[model samples]
Target: MIETTPGIIISFVLYLIFMLLIGWIFYRRTQNLSDYILGGRGLNTWVTSMSAQASDMSGWLLLGLPGYAYIAGLESIWIAVGLAVGTYFNWRFIAQRLRKYTQIAGNSLTLPDYFENRFRANSKILRIVSALFILIFFLIYTASGFVAGAKLFNTVFGLSYIGALSIGVLVIIAYTFLGGFMAVSWTDFFQGMLMFIAILVVPLIAIGTMGGIDSTAASINAKNSELLNALTQIDGTTISAISIISL
Candidate 1:
C-alpha cells in the first residue's frame, strides 16, 4: 500500500478550489468574442509573458520533467534546458514582433488575421490554412494535457483512467469557453506558479527524506548497479531514461 500525506492532499484540494473560483470570477469579463479570445489584448507585459509560457507548457513542466529525470538520468535535464532556451528565444525574437504586428494589423487578435493582413493574400486561403494549423496543433497540445491529467488522477487519487481523461478535457474546455484568453492567461500564471513551487519543493522534500543526493544515488545504485554505470557498455548504449520519460 502507498503512504498518504494528509497535508499535501488538503493543500492540493484547496488549490483546485482556488482555480475554480478564479475561473468563475473571470466568467463575467468575457462578454464578447474578443474579450473571450484575446482578453481584449489588455494584459501587461508581465502577465502576457507569464501567461504565454504557462499556456505553452501546462502540465508537462510540472509532472513530465522530473519523472523523466528519475526514470532516465541526467540526460533529462537537456529537455528542461532546451525548453528554457526556446522560451528565451521566443521572447527575444518573436514576442515583440507578434505584439507589434498584432496591434499594427488593425488590432488583429488571432494569428490568421495577422497573416492575412501582413501578406494581403488574394484568396483568404492563407488565413484558412493558418486556422487549420492552429486548430490541429492546439487540439494535439490540449489532448496531451488530457493524457497528463489522466496520469495524475490515476497516480494521486486512483481515479478510473477514462473518467480522469473525460474530467480533464471537460474542465479545460469549460474554463476556456467561459473566460477565453484572459481566463486562460490568468489561470496559466497561477498554475505556473503552483507548478514552479511544487517542482522546486518536491525535490527538496525527497532529498531530505532520502538523506541527501549522495545517499539517494547510492541507494539507487544498490538497487540497480547498471543504472549508475555509464551510458555505453560494449557498444550497447542504453537509452537515457530522462529524455524518454520527459517525452
Candidate 2:
C-alpha cells in the first residue's frame, strides 16, 4: 500500500482533470459517427502507434509481468521477446493492410462491420456473430483493466475496492462518452509515455540505488544464483517448452 500524502492526492486530482479536459475538447470536435468512432481516421503515426501500445499492454505490463519476473527470474525474457516479435508482425503485416481494407470495405468503422462488408454477407449473420464474439471476449478483457485500475486506486488512496472500482468506471465512461476515439487516442498516448517511464526508470533507479548493475546482480546471486538464469526457473528447474507455449 502507498503512504497517503496531500501531494499525491493533488497530483491524481490534477491528472484526472487534465484527462477530462482533453476529452471535453475532443467532444466539441466530434461531429459524426466517423469522427466519434474513428477519430476521422486522422491520427498521426505517433498517436496511433503509442495509443495502440498503451492499450495493448495496459497495467498487465507493470503489475502482473513484474510479479511473474520476481518469481520466475529470467524466464520472463521469453514473454518479453514474444511480445516484441508479435507486436512487430502485427503492425507490419496486419494493421497496415487492415486499415486500407476497412476503408475499401464500404468505409467500415468496426471489426464486425469490416468483416460483414468484406465478405458480402447478405444474411448479416457474420456481423452479428462477430459482434457477439467480440462482446463476449471484450467483457472478460475489459474486466482485467477495470480490476487493475481498482487495485491501483485502492492501494494508492486507501480507498475501498468498491469505491475505487466505481470511480475508475465512472472516469472511463466519462472520457469515452465525451471524446470517443480521438480523446482515447490522445490520452492513451500520454498514459503510455508515463507507463514507459515508470517501467524503465523505476528499475534503473532501483538498480543504481542498490549500487549498480554488477552489485545488484551480486546481491541477487547471493540469495539465489538461479535468479540470473534465463533458461531455468528460480527453483533451478529447467523451464519446459510446454510451459513456454502455454504462457
Candidate 3:
C-alpha cells in the first residue's frame, strides 16, 4: 500500500486545529475553577453519561478491548460483560446519590469536601488519604493514556517513542488545563465516537479480510492444531478454570 504522506499530515493538522478551536471556545466561557473543573455542575444526563463513560473507558474500550478479544478468544467477552454490569450499577446506584450528595453538601465543589460533608465530620486523615489516592491513580491513568498515544504515534508516523510520549502528555495537559471539564467532555464526545467507529470497523475488516469465519478457522487449524484449542499453560501451570472475582 502506498503511503499518502502529505494527505496524512494534512489530516493530522486539521484534527489538531479542530481540537484547539474547541479548547478556545471553552476557555472563553471559563470564568473560574468551577467552570473548568465541573462545567458549572449543570451537565445534563446525556453529556454527563457520555462524558463519564468515555473518560472512564479511555483507550481501554477502543484498543484494549478488541485486542483482548482477538488474543483471548471468546473468553474475553467476560471483560465486556463485567464493564456493562459495573456501568449499570454505577448509573442505577451511585450516580444519583453522588449528584444529590454533592449539591446537598453546600456545593462542596471538590471530591474530598463532598466526602467529608457526607459523613458530617472533618476527618483530616480520610480527606488526605482520598486526595492522595486521587493524585496517585490519576497520575497513573494519565500516564497510561500517554503511553497508548505514544505507541500509536510510533506505529503510525515512525516518531521516536519518547518524543511521542512527551508530545502526548503535553497535548493532553494543555487542553485539560485550558478548558478542564468542558474540554474533556466535548473532546470525549468526539473521541468516543471515533473510538466506537474504530473498534467496530477494525474487527469487521479483519474478519472480512480473512475470507470468512469457517475458512479462517480452517486455515488456522491447518497451520497449527493448537490454534483450534484453548490455551492450557499459564506460567507453566494448567489453567484449570478461570473466573472473575469482584471485591
Best by lDDT: 2
lDDT winner between 1 and 3, please give it.
Answer: 1
| Per-residue accuracy of model 3 over 1-247 as CA lDDT, tens digit each | 2254988978876776777677878988999877887899877777777778778888767667667655655445556777889889989998788888898987777788887877777558767888899999998997777778888777777789998788777766777777788987887788777777877887778768999887778875666544345433222233344454230
lDDT of 1 by residue, 145-216 (tens): 889888887788777999878877776677777677887888788877777688789889998999999998
Query: What TM-score do all the candidates reach, one by one?
Result: 0.83, 0.96, 0.86
On lDDT, the stronger of 2 and 3 is: 2
The worst-scoring run of ten residues by lDDT in candidate 2 lies at 238-247
Candidates 1 and 3, the one with greater TM-score? 3
**After superposing candidate 3, which stretches have Cα over 4 Å from the reference?**
1-4, 220-242, 245-247
Cα lDDT listed for each candidate: 0.76, 0.92, 0.74
Which lDDT tens digits does candidate 2 get at residues 106-149?
99999999999999989989999999999999898789999999
Relative to the true structure, candidate 3 reaches a TM of: 0.86
Off by over 4 Å in 1: 1-14, 221-247
What is the C-alpha local distance difference test score of candidate 3?
A: 0.74
